[model samples]
Target: MAGEEFEYEYLYKALAKYANEHQYPLAQQAYEGAGAAEKIHAAILKEAANVKTYEGTTVYVCPICGYVMAGDSIPERCPVCGGPERQYEKF
Candidate 1:
């Protein structure tokens, strides 16, 4: 799963770079947003390797950049994208 996440992160970053070179602002932002999620996913997987079991937890995902948080409530803004807490989705 970590390998897959890293692969996706690389793909998104490459797409973002290409979009930027082509002057496609929206496409670039979209790819970058996806990349943020993939980046977080890889990190989470790496750290989760120490865990032996999973339990109930509320997970939040930032809509703008796909940032993630595991808690009872979300932060005022996404640390990665600065998206508002209201914009985050429960997962």
Candidate 2:
């Protein structure tokens, strides 16, 4: 999982860099979203390593955006994309 995260991080960073250099704002935003998603995934892995358990926890992923949140309940809106709670998919 860590290796996958790093791969995605590297890929998104490269995409973002290339898109920005070529003045593709939309592509850059999409790459940024992908990068943000990987970052959240990495953070969750780090947290899991520290806690050593996923019991009594919930992970929510936004469908419209790559936003992710771990908690007891889904957030009212995605922090990254402002999607509603109903748009989130639980994992």
Query: Tens-digit lDDT track for model 1 on 1-91?
Result: 6565865757888999999999999999878877776777777777678777546767788877767787686679887677888888887
- TM-score per candidate, in order? 0.69, 0.75
Cα RMSD, each candidate: 2.9, 2.4
Q: In model 2, what are the clashing residue pairs, if there are any?
A: none
lDDT of candidates 1 onward, in order? 0.78, 0.81
Where does candidate 1 stray beyond 4 Å? 54-58, 63-65, 71-74, 80-82, 87-91
What is the Å distance of residue 14 in model 2 from its true position?
A: 2.1
TM-score of 1: 0.69
The CA lDDT at 87 in model 2 is 79
Model 1 weakest lDDT span, ten residues long: 1-10
